[model samples]
Target: MTAAPVEGELAMVGEVAEQLRDVRRHVDFFDNDVHQARDLAREADSRSLATETTVAGFARWLERLEQSNEALRRETATLRGHHPPDPQRPPRHRCSRYAPPIHLSALGEEAGDTA
Candidate 1:
């Protein structure tokens, strides 16, 4: 039978995922600004009747921010799919203090990068 990923390996993947997710999250960290930009664009339509350049510029920026956020979400989902968490395992998430078990046998080799 194949061996499962060791707890430490899973923890490392989890840590990496968390860090990467955090970085991706920062791509659109200004959520408030996105919403405000959208609101301003809508209001500008009423105030300027689609004549103001600033409104269109803000609209484009907001759209790009939204797209980036969607892409990041997709990436996070893909990452989770590859490294699902096992709550039963220790070294939960970023808690990497738990030492990795010794795995020198064939099964350990079979575990691949997962440990």
Candidate 2:
């Protein structure tokens, strides 16, 4: 009710208001820091997921390449065995003709004549 007491009450209220403002600024700073930390954590997790995906893709690609190489080796072997040499020419025949040569008893017989 008195003027001095009223002035004293107003000053006290002003100090309380200033302290509240400082507390609010500190809370805002802390909230921003928490949000930034969460964002960084999410980014790290996303990077880890991408790296795992890349590694898995590389593993699959390597497996396919190995399968392709094995298939090529099998095809090469099959191609090598597919052709048969001319049996009429004994010198040009393949090594599959490995039997022992039976020399002709008659002197008039030819080299490549099987008859």
Candidate 3:
């Protein structure tokens, strides 16, 4: 006979699904806003005036969205403890090639050493 799901387990699953849905909705909203901001920034760029304010506003919006996304991810991880791909650890593979340039002078090291 198949075992039935416990009340707490079912409740947790429902909560997780709801949270996942919320995360998706927020992501969609954030994406739409970002697209709109990009369009506005492009328009401002075409004009004589600087688009700094518009771009800054878009950056702020993106920051908030990123924060919310991170929080939701943490919450989901907590709900599903001991799952694969532990959030605390970094991935093994080198995902990207965009490393920030190191300033040797700032670090009190010779620039030649960095080569």
Best-performing candidate as measured by lDDT: 2
Model 2 lDDT per residue over 38-97, tens place: 999999999999999999999999999999997887788578784443458555455555
TM of each candidate vs. truth: 0.28, 0.61, 0.36
Scored against the true structure, residue 108 in model 2 reaches a CA lDDT of 56
- Note the Cα lDDT for every prediction shown: 0.76, 0.85, 0.80
lDDT per residue as tens, model 3, 1-115: 2345677788899999999999999999999999999999888777735567678889999999999998887788679773446668886574453576766677765666867
Candidate 1 ranges beyond 4 A from true positions:
1-5, 27-32, 50-115
Report the Cα lDDT for residue 112, model 3.
63
How far residue 27's Cα lies from its native spot in candidate 2, in Å, is: 0.8
- Arrange candidates, best lDDT first: 2, 3, 1
Global local distance difference test of model 1: 0.76
lDDT of 1 by residue, 22-73 (tens): 9878866778678889999999777786566678889999999999997887
